[model samples]
Target: MRHVVAAVAGLIFALGLGISGMTDPGKVIGFLDVGGAWEPALAFVMGGAVVVYALAYRLIVRRPRPVVEVKFSLPTAKKVTTSLVVGSALFGIGWGLGGYCPGPALTSVVSGSWEVGLFVVTMLAGMGLHQVWERLSARGSAAAAPAPAAPLAEGPLKGVDA
Candidate 1:
């Protein structure tokens, strides 16, 4: 049931992206271009999306649990950490360079665009690399962690009350 809901939601989202021209790399690039022939149409689309999301979020969060899920999945982190900053920066850079973020890129895959296909491939590779890097870092941190102190050999207190 959850899977069906997820699939339906994804289908709707993909249709929205396609209908809004968000799946077009050229349109995205044009929107990102601030100096030369900047296209502002996407801005309106984004603003509308934000407004809808804000309202929907408020309404949905008022419920104790989501319609499909037992609990609403929300971000618990409040402080802006270095990882967040770095990840956001990287995402911005990738979006600017490739002119296609993950959502639109995935939606556009059916269009049979080589650029979109390449972007998806590289994005997957980057995700895999990140997983490998995190695993290696976790192992390194675990190895660097201090070991627990060994107990002292049986002392006089062992045979006598303190």
Candidate 2:
């Protein structure tokens, strides 16, 4: 049932992408080329997405928990770290060069374009490399660190163990 729902949703999303000209690398590249032969349609798509997400988030947050989940799985990290900066830079560079991110790249694959195939291949390779790097970093940190001591205070009341 979940798979059926997911497939239907994916099909709808892909249709939207195709209809919106997001599956065309030329259109995306034109959007990125701000100074020369720029296409502003992508901005409208982004703005629509932002508005939808803003309203959806507000609605979702009003609920104590999501209908499909026990709790919201929010990221704990808040700081802008080196990894975040490097990742953002890499993403921006890839988008500028290929004119296709993962979502659009996947959709473009259906168009049977060789450029889309190449972009998807490179994107998969990047994802694999990221997974490998993350595993190695996690192992290194685990091997180098010792467990921290527990907090002196406990429970609802201060300095209480109950």
lDDT scores in order? 0.79, 0.74
Off by over 4 Å in 1: 146-162
Decoy 1 TM-score against native: 0.85
Candidate 1 on 74-106: residue-level lDDT in tens? Answer: 755456657667987999999988889889999
Q: In candidate 2, how many clashes are counted?
A: 0
lDDT of 2 at 134: 64
Which window of ten consecutive residues has the lowest lDDT sum in model 2?
153-162
- What TM-score would you give candidate 2 relative to the actual structure? 0.80
| Model 2 ranges off by over 4 Å | 147-162
| lDDT score, candidate 2, position 6 | 74
3-105 in candidate 2: lDDT tens per residue?
A: 6777988998888777787877789899999999988988888787789889998988889986666786654455666766888798898888877878889
